[model samples]
Target: MAKETKAQRETVERVMREWKDGALETSRGAPVTSQQQAVAIALHEAGQSRDETPAKNRKNLRTTKAREAKASETREVLYAEATKRGIPGRSRMTKQELVRALQPR
Candidate 1:
């Protein structure tokens, strides 16, 4: 494995600081609740996480499909939640739109 560069470390540190300050969140806009969780998420975003298995030794296609299936399930759940809340025009909103609309003001 290649060594991590100074820039990568700096980036991770910055993200960690932001997360600790409640200024950063996951792609879904959920706040990170812990420093350890922040480190993992930051490293994954930087492509420097220690937990990634070698792609050649893994079933890449199956993993990708599984992730997609999970995302679809999440979208369905969000849609249903929005429907339950009686959000106007929910049927016409995309998943992300629903998410944004559902966020507390």
Candidate 2:
């Protein structure tokens, strides 16, 4: 395989940073999947224009949205149940907190 140029290396590093830091989320705040990351990397490597990145990113965003939506639905159900059971502070908890509280005791 050919060696990566500095520009290519920089681009890859940027993408990896975004992926690791959860910047590839949808407007609704869903985390992008590995598959989506792969697609974004592939597109970037192909020398796709910067202006076109958003469209390509949106495609991946859709998948993340779907996954997040499903997870949200499940969390809502769990949260409601927790509230009904008088779990203190459930109302104030964020999603991550809710998950921890709802985990099997």
Candidate 3:
């Protein structure tokens, strides 16, 4: 097997450090899925420069934020509907619970 060059060794080390440090977390404050981590690792291995990484990460963050906002809005609507119908425990319910409780019996 051919020996790895210095640059390839450096790239591997960087990717490993990022993974160990949990630096690839998703925008929603969750750990990135293994699939995402693999993509990022592949990109880094391809010698993609660091200057481009932030922009791609930022775009992902914006999309995650939008999705979270939509989910929050849906939860709020469910809460409002439950309150209007005098459903008890609405305030205590999680978003999923609120959705279920607000559904037509």
lDDT of candidates 1 onward, in order = 0.67, 0.58, 0.58
Q: After TM-score superposition, what is the CA distance of residue 12 in candidate 2 from its true location, in Å?
A: 0.2
**Model 2 accuracy (lDDT, Cα):** 0.58
What's model 2's lDDT at 50?
57
- Segments in model 2 whose C-alpha atoms lie over 4 Å from true places: 25-30, 39-43, 46-105
Error of 3 at 67 (Å): 18
Indicate which candidate wins on TM-score.
Answer: 1
Off by over 4 Å in 3: 1-73
Model 3: colliding residue pairs = none
- Compute the lDDT of residue 49 as modeled in candidate 2: 32
Write down the worst ten-residue block by lDDT for model 3: 60-69
**lDDT tens digits, residue span 1-105, model 1:** 767666556656777888878987876778888888898766665556657764521343333334434445567787898889999998888886876777655
Best by lDDT: 1
How do the candidates rank by TM-score, highest first? 1, 2, 3
lDDT of 1 at 100: 71
Clashing pairs in 2: none
**How many clashes show up per model?**
0, 0, 0
